[model samples]
Target: MAPTAALLLLLSLASVCFPAAAEETLVFVTVLFRHGDRSPVRAYPTDPYQESSWPQGFGQLSQEGMRQHFELGQFLRSRYGNLLNGSYDRHEISVRSTDYDRTLMSAEANLAGLYPPSGGQVFNPSLKWQPIPVHTVPQSEERLLLFPRNDCPRYTQLVNETEHTEEVLNITAEYWDFIEFVNNKTGLKNTGVDSMWGVYDTLFCESRHNMTPPDWVTPDVQQKLRVLKDFSFQIMFGIYKRVEKSRLQGGMLLGEIVKNLSKMAAPDPQQRLKLKMLSAHDTTIAALQSSLNVYSGKQPPYASCHIFELHRDDNGSASVSMFFRNDSGAAPYPVQLPGCPLRCPLEDFVRLTQPSVSQDRDKECQLPSEGRDKEILLILALSAGALLLLIALLLAVVCWRREPMAARGYQHVLNQEGGGDDS
Candidate 1:
């Protein structure tokens, strides 16, 4: 009896420590990462370095950018090797990037590190790389990943309104002198909190490349710019009516991701696709995180990745876990939805995030009065114009009918008689 009791005690301890991990299976993963570092998208008017200074011109990815993505790819391989096959399988994975040179090239460089051509796959002995397709659409048509779309007039109005909020007013008041100083140094006329990101980005790019900034850019000034730059993202995605803003901007992507997760949750005997990789901009990451209400209020660094792992437990219940890999040297940190646990149940996650998602983006993007009021005004204007036209025609007929018989007699009667006798 003592030996049997001891065995039961051992089994209980094992169960407590293991926590049914063996029953859970990792079924699908979605990875969204910012493109690697690049040159300044554009330079300020008074900047010493212009587009001509960079080898590949402005906004192009640099050598360091390629290296950063390559290392990131290697890290992903080490982390996900058990889930992915040793060699690349196109059917099991999909890679997409924004239709830009930097993102496309970053995906390519990352693929090189993730799947170094081996054995029969090696086309050339000298070169260690192989071709892999990265899909993209034209920038104008990209709605899923791009944020703060200008096509949405309501979103534009939201931004304009956000600029006038008390918080924004306070920020403006506090930074007024700093804004003036930056405008003076950068020779920019409009340098407010909303537009200061451009200046910060220019300086950050220059600093990353070891370029010497102007004497005015001390460390303190740089730090201030960085803070404002981060705040700019907040202003665009959060600050006011965040859920509505997300419904227009980031929620589209989130909705698609949730659909993918749902599809994977269904029983499929032929489920070949396991991973989806998206290569996009920092704004994409920020917008999606904001929609999830998991934004850290800091900039997503170059090559930073957000991961979603879906696991199915023994009873066929699926749960999702989120992790953000911001630093290359450190492990990814877990992210919990505002009220959900780190590993949130699939239904709970969908329910919590549904408010952020939009059923019809175009319909939701219309302003409160845009759909009914503007359309009604147009219909009324058209109806009024038509009524006025009809009234004018009737008045002309009345005037002609009211003319005296003598005035209408001679020429009119002669013409009518010449034409026909019925009148």
Candidate 2:
């Protein structure tokens, strides 16, 4: 009501309407992407193009695949130009890939686009690229990058259970005609639902390369096969107890990512890593999406990427945001974790994903004790008891033999005592 009070009120209103912009800083980022296009890993028995037909043999990255990854690198550079150094700094970023040639090469190609040589960093004047280290372990030892690890007996059991699900059975019945057609076309015997994806992959790759597919692979047939392939992909990473599957497979990677995010969120002056990149497979992406409940029920396209960005506000509150870059030409689509906002709080993100993460994947993968194992334990117990009894009997027999010697010694002592009395 007073002049000074009114002015103060107006100032407070302005501050409320337009607060000082909170300083939001990017703290850490993790990007996991499927390797770009490649030749089919293998063809069916009757396929025309075999491994030799591919320039670098089966399952190797194609020229287009290299270009796709390079473009992806460019996209990364554009997106994080401010956060990343103009040239490659080994301490700032770490790149890892599956131990497959395609994935390894894709990472290298991506690095080329992400950190092209500039200024004094150029090793060769003509070449635009500088060698940035990309790390990988052997495929057998790789758990983070590889999804649905075959070594997991529990995962295999889950797959077996999934096979009997009503959905899978119905899909199998629906695709019976297509399966028979593939068998006939490919000259393979007993081609079933599980193996049909191979046929689809071969046909799809051929079609991609402008090679004429077999006459029977008409649009309708191709479409059906595509559906089957997508279904197969779902079965591999989803379809039943998706979160449980993630605990044993994809969740391992997710846990690692969350750990890195949490570490970076902490105020650590020594923290050097700003970016972590993983070059993996489509299944890797699918497993992660399935765990996060963001899967779109289709196979991730080649060079598809899922990004986790960790940001901290001026108040030191941390949040996470996810984006999917499936299409190289377009901007990435924002992916929200189920039950959380687009920019999910770091604590909520970790809590929501806790179910998927495992404390010990290998231990979790151990199958539950079965009747056979119980029976073996019983036998071992019985055997141990019998051995103990046998040892006791042997000790008793030795004691009995010693008793006769003691009796003889007593008789000799009595005879000596009688002789002394007669004397």
Candidate 3:
């Protein structure tokens, strides 16, 4: 009896101590990253490099850009090797890029580092690279892969409101003298807040390549310009009602990401795609970060990446985790969404981001009917009056041309009498 009692006690202890271990499985990942470094998009009209100085002309990627993406690919492989297969698998991953040479090439280079050929996958003996397709759409048709889409009138209206904000005004006033100096130095016509980014970009790219900037660009002046440029970027996506701005711009991408995550969380036996990669510009990264409220107020550096990871546990519950890999040498840092845990539950993630996701972007971008009511009414009134006048003119013309039936009969009789006289 004592032995039996001891056995029962041991069984109870085991049941209490060894409750089923919670199983955590990585389900899906979405990565959005800026293209690697490249030549200036365009130089000022008075600048030295112009269009001819660059090897591949304006906006082409440099060799350093290739290296940067390759290293980034290696980092991804190390971080996700367990989740992703060792070799390139088309069914498991999809990559999309903007229709730009730099971005397209960056995707190709990153793939090289992420998946080097092994065993039967090697097509060429000497080269370690294998072709992995990178897809893109024309710039005009691209909406998903880009941000701050110009077609959104609501976003444009928001931008106008942002410009009129007191903060923007103060920044403009603070830099009035600097703007004048830049205008005078560059001989650029009508230089102001709108055109300052061009000057800063030209100078920045030149400085990065060891080219001497103009003497007028003193350290203090450069710092001020940097501040203004940063401010400009902030206002472009942040400042004054950022959430609404996101609904029309960056939130489109986020919405797609959230939808993909939710779909992955569903139980499916044939779910093969493990990763989706987007190769885009610095603005793309900044816009997404702004939507997430994680932007650091500075432009995203070259090859910066934001990662979205979905994890599912054994209990049939799923959660989302986000990480930012802005620095090449360091590990990706975790970022928490506002009003949610760092590893937020999937349902909570969807709910928190739903407000920013627009159901119909075109509808949201349309101008309000109230604002155009008066103009439309005036146009309609003018059209109706013109139509009435046209009808009156037609009636008058028909009346003037009409001949009386009696006059027609009398003419016929006169003709008959004339014929009898002739006979």
Candidate 4:
């Protein structure tokens, strides 16, 4: 009995020290990138390509986008093969996208290459692919799109307050002049679509595809356009001092983005996460990287990815590392996240990313301040009340004056004279 007890005690000790294989692995990722390029998503009034110019309609992903995403999918598979089983594990991964055709379709194309039909997928002899869900919300409805740049009232208020600061107001004035100049030059609608990205996309596409600019575009005008565009892009990215100071003062979107990172990073350090993906536009990435205090002038080229690795150091302390791959470098590509060591501590990672909290807003949003109908109603009510009050006061004054016999007598004399004249 003593010998048997000793063996059981030894077995128990070994079990306590050795963790199960299932619990030993934990990995999570959040990725953001621009859509692969083709034709412009929007057109100036005189752009050569209309809805039907490309094989695909405007704003739809092109063949080039499909190929770009497929390549990305393969890269993901090569990178995460051991962690993922041959079968697609629904619980193991979650994929989300902004509800644009190009973004949604890019996710689909990427998924096809990343997790091709393996076990049951092979059963369909005809080879038609099975459906996989890529969750998305409409752009207008997307909180994620507005992330790190929340549309919340508090954030807007903060931005408004900040905008009044000398730095912000100056930039706003400077950019307005630049915007007007572009409008006059481009002969474009000068409405919502005329941003730095739009201008750059136009020039980039024109130069790449051998398309000539409209007859209105002159050589000097093109140079000026590029210069203004570069400045606008810098301001937009918070690279310029004025923009950086204003935006840093406080912002709704930036606050929300930090909150989101906290949520993702807060998940159990030991919990297993297989695959995570984000489908977003170039601007989306800019917001996220900006939240992390990283921004470059141009939007992250299409399909660029930011990678984070979570691990523990030799001291058995948890740590993290961040990498950005814009695919621009020639030899040693992909920049590391700054302030974070090549392999940073998880605590340090949180500290670096925690600047997002500075953006948290303190107010709610009901509606945009410019509600025309509401303003009209208020104006009408005020006008009617004022007119009624004026009429009443005029009547009261007339009655008071009439109490004096002179006014009454003068009216009577005028009436008699008018009657004689009529006769």
lDDT scores in order: 0.90, 0.88, 0.87, 0.60
Q: In candidate 2, which residue pairs get closer than 3 Å at backbone N, Cα or C atoms, i.e. clash?
A: none
In candidate 1, the residue pairs with backbone N, CA or C atoms under 3 Å apart (3 or more residues apart, or in different chains) clash, namely none
Tens-digit lDDT track of model 2 for 72-95: 999999999988998889999999
Residue pairs clashing, model 4: 148-253, 148-254, 148-257, 149-253, 149-254, 150-252, 150-253, 255-359, 319-346
Per-residue accuracy of model 4 over 1-423 as CA lDDT, tens digit each: 699999998889888998443322234555555666666666665566555655666667767777788777777777778867666777767788888888888888888778877667666767635567899877677765434344454344444455365654565565676566666655666432125457656756555456777765677656656655544444444543323322433233444433444454554555555566777777666656665666665556766776655543334455555667666222114445578666665666666655453432222232335455578889999999999999999976875565546545566556646773222
Give the local distance difference test score of model 2.
0.88
Error of 1 at 39 (Å): 0.6
What is the full ranking by lDDT, best candidate first? 1, 2, 3, 4
- Candidate 1, residue 337: lDDT: 90
Q: Considering only N, C-alpha and C atoms within 3 Å, which residue pairs clash in candidate 3?
A: none
Candidate 2 vs. true structure, TM-score: 0.87
**Relative to the unseen true structure, what is the C-alpha lDDT of residue 7 in candidate 1, on a scale of 0 to 100?**
100
Better model by TM-score: candidate 2 vs candidate 4: 2
Each model's RMSD to truth, in Å? 6.7, 6.0, 7.6, 12.4
Kindly state the number of residue pairs that clash in model 2.
Answer: 0
Per-model TM-score, in order, reads 0.86, 0.87, 0.85, 0.64
Model 2 poorest 10 in a row by lDDT: 414-423
Task: Name the candidate that leads on lDDT.
Answer: 1
Score candidate 4 by lDDT.
Answer: 0.60
Model 3 scores a TM of 0.85
- Model 1 C-alpha RMSD to native: 6.7
